[model samples]
Target: MELEALHQVQGVQGSSYPIYLGEGLLDDALPNMIVERGYTNIAIATNETLEPLYGKPLVKRLREYDSYMIVLPDDEKYSGLNTVHIIFNQLLLRNADRSTVIVALGGRVIIELVSFVGATYMYGVDVINCPTTPLAMVDTSIGGKGAIDLPQGRNLIGTFKDPIAVFADLQSLETLPVSEMRNGLAGIVKTALVGDPDLIDMLTPDDQSRLAYRPERLRTIIERAMAVKVPIVEADHTGLGERLHLNLGYTFAFALEKATGYKLPHGEALAVGLVAAVRLSHRMGLCDAALVQRTEQVLQSLNPSNAPVSYAIPQGRAIDVWEAMRHDPKWRQGKARFVLLQGPGQPIIHDDVPQELVLEVIESLADGVYPRPRSWRMVL
Candidate 1:
């Protein structure tokens, strides 16, 4: 993974933060990077899935720093107020203060949980994130939209607080199962279409499975995906403007998650949503049908994790998905705001997608499924 690069996420009033992209930075460079910055204490927070595999070893490596560990619940269902209270209790007990830098050392859920924790902890402490998963490294870790799920829906309670820095260590991906890799690819594929359309050329049909284990190509993909997000973030810190383009297929993605009672993994669900978005574009005459055909071809190639779940959202529940779309944070005024593709790189933000057409597009995504590659283990 030689695609090491330094990206600056511009902040308000001309301020900015650095995102260090490389392999082995988490357990190698991160400790000294924190200490050298004059931070006196550190709070490394991760989920149960990552604590033993990555977090504990990292804490031992950084034993010299005034740092303690906080292990969060692994399941998304636990990412609510109760989880927040638990984190607060742990921080209070360990004397985590304003000087303490909360290093979010896991995938999106834990990263966002700890981000919100860092944002509100002692009226906001600095957060330096380590995104272990692919989806997180490129998407969640960049934008400061630290969010937590509420019983009513996902990401209901959130804050727009950027991390002091982001360290995306490619080495951490070695332990992840194929499904986890595909989860990140969903975001990567989206980034290519929305930001750098040329990146899609790399995901040739035969290269999709190999890209997961192939270090050089995978690193380049992650780096390019991150590159696509930075400029939009700098321009719109709050997700009211072009940043919404980042949510290309999330309208249907979030709805499926809600419709399924949040059982479907986000990335897998998003693959299906991307298909829905492109199909909607064709149905509305915004783009040619070839675009939808090409989308399915690409998403199908990135199998197992991202091969749009073999789901035909039961019409009874499809209506539930439609309702979920209405309450979606991205929903504009009284209509659904869909970021549909006019072509590969040309995304159009349409805020007036009618309810009937949205359902038709959602239904058409269930044509067929391609058999996914063998997974070494279950997704975290």
Candidate 2:
């Protein structure tokens, strides 16, 4: 299969690198890319679940070269200082120097921890990302924002280190569970909602289910979604300005994940949070009711159950979620800021969102009072 490459300008000064996506990308393209970049030693950091599936095959390909592997737990509970330390220890044991290249292979958890490790080890080192899941392929792996969760909330500890190159091996996605597939779709949906409205047409309830089984369509969807993210990262690599527009639905999304002990996947939580954001946007008169309806309609299409309601907050937990949101990484001066949409593809960062209205929207979602798409009850 032919590999497609796109260059993304990263960091404050706009350093550039290519993002390669397609099946069989690791066969020769990845190794050649690594050597051309002048990396000497190679280290593969991945989760145990993915080690055998992907990490091993990659290690085999680079067997003639000096390489090491560090496998971490796939669970969020294991994503923290300890994991980073373990990876660093491995690098130290292997005598990995500044020229050592860290290859982050796996889903979001592995990507976050490995990226952070690569950034912190020897202050910084080059990293090549082979994002195995759709979520990483489209969003996280491309943006250069590496983070680890703490007791306070998700992504509490993080750093920015652009990958030397991002190799998205689409074949790796063949084994992804349906839940993970849906999780990745959440990123694509958010991309369309906030930036590329035309991409929304691909996510209709009627056609979305087919995407999980169709590789060609999935590739097109990912490429279109990344088109929305690449320019934003190029313009605001540090995420101090325009890039915050991509925070749409993240406040509520993280709070929900915390409340559920991460029982809900990140993308699913974001889908529910998207509905809440749309509801609040309507309440604030930032968008018409039709927009909220349409947004929820697309989200509900992701899963079999009626969203936001299917993943309802437990009784008396609405206030808990609100409290958690106050501690969001983006909150400023005790105010919970949100990326509110003015309309499809028009997003504005607003910290003035009224707390009472926010609480009202959460309470309504808890009570299942917010209007949802009519076809939500039918399972695809």
Candidate 3:
């Protein structure tokens, strides 16, 4: 049964790879990927957490080729320089060379690890991103921003190497924790807020004034978000130009993640970041207060606290996440750059964002200065 729901994203950016989005695509996508890429030898880079679930199936499918599976420890905390070294060691031991295709078969952590290795390995090798999580599919796995976390900051060591292909199997999302699913939505929200007015409309309901998460609805949202991202990446494959627009939502997202010591998932921090951007936009007179409030309403509806797991992150953690942002290399010159919304589909990268304003917006959310929708209002 071929799932016709898949959306094919033609590479407007770096290498002109294809993004396959749909259910039950793995069966067809994996083998075709190997043959199409001319990868006679392949390595599946995964983590202990995901190896048990999909690794064997993938291995069996690609068994005809000289394939090896590399599994790393499966926790976000373990994603670091040491992890990168382990991947390199395995690749070297396997005699993986330029012809070897590194298949990142897990979430953001695994993708970052493999992509980093691919970028630096023998001056670069082929990388195929097989993102299993919604977070990976909608955000991390799409763009070529690869990095591992450091004690001082998250993604401190990384590179901009676009993947040869990104195969996002939505069926894999079934295995993801609810927290991770919600976290992935944060990226979609950021994509919308930065640009993609159509996505913003889809995310915000007219009658309810809140965000809604229907599977079909989300698929379209993810597609729209990718549309916004692909063009920017195409214009500046190395992130030297319009690509900075994508980072507008990311700056706050990364800072919040670091501030919380990564206790918060990437998507949760992104939700906070989107709200921060909206508030910042309002303060800068780029957008209206109503727009900010409406945006908050949509986000509050999708907050992870409303999920079955109800991840209770502390206010102190959120503050710490903000503090960590201060040390980010991008902010090294004592000034932070932010992507603030000028209007729907209009995102302006501002290098002059006041530190005070950024701090105030984070504090407001942490302190409940702004009213959170009842659905998301909870004492952490």
Alpha-carbon local distance difference test for all models: 0.80, 0.79, 0.71
For candidate 1, the per-residue lDDT at 79 reads 80
Cα lDDT of model 3 by residue, 191-229, tens digit: 776666657566544544234345566567667777777
As for TM-score, the candidate ahead, 2 or 3, is 2
Better structure of 1 and 3 per TM-score: 1
Runs off by more than 4 Å, candidate 1: 1-5, 207-212, 304-310, 368-380
Local error of candidate 1 at residue 131 (angstroms): 0.5
Off by over 4 Å in 3: 1-14, 36-38, 204-215, 304-323, 368-380
Q: Candidate 1: deviation at residue 134, Å? A: 1.1
User: Highest lDDT, which number?
Assistant: 1
Runs in model 2 deviating more than 4 A are 1-4, 205-212, 305-310, 367-380
lDDT (Cα, tens digit) per residue for candidate 2, span 312-367: 66777788888878778677887778998999999988886788898888876764
Query: What is the per-residue lDDT of model 1 for residues 1-380, given as tens digits with 9 covering 90 to 100?
Result: 33334887897677778899887797767886787788767788998889898888888887877777889777767788898999899889988888888889988888888888888988998998899998999999997888888766778788888888899988888888665777787788888889888787676445334543677777888888888999999999988889989888888888888888887777778888888888888988899988888777777766644554456666555678888877778775687789988888888898788888987776765555434567633222
Better of 1 and 2 by lDDT: 1
TM-score of each: 0.92, 0.92, 0.84
The TM-score obtained by model 2 is: 0.92
Rank the candidate models, highest lDDT first: 1, 2, 3
* Model 1 Cα shift for residue 188 (angstroms): 0.7
lDDT of 2 at 250: 89
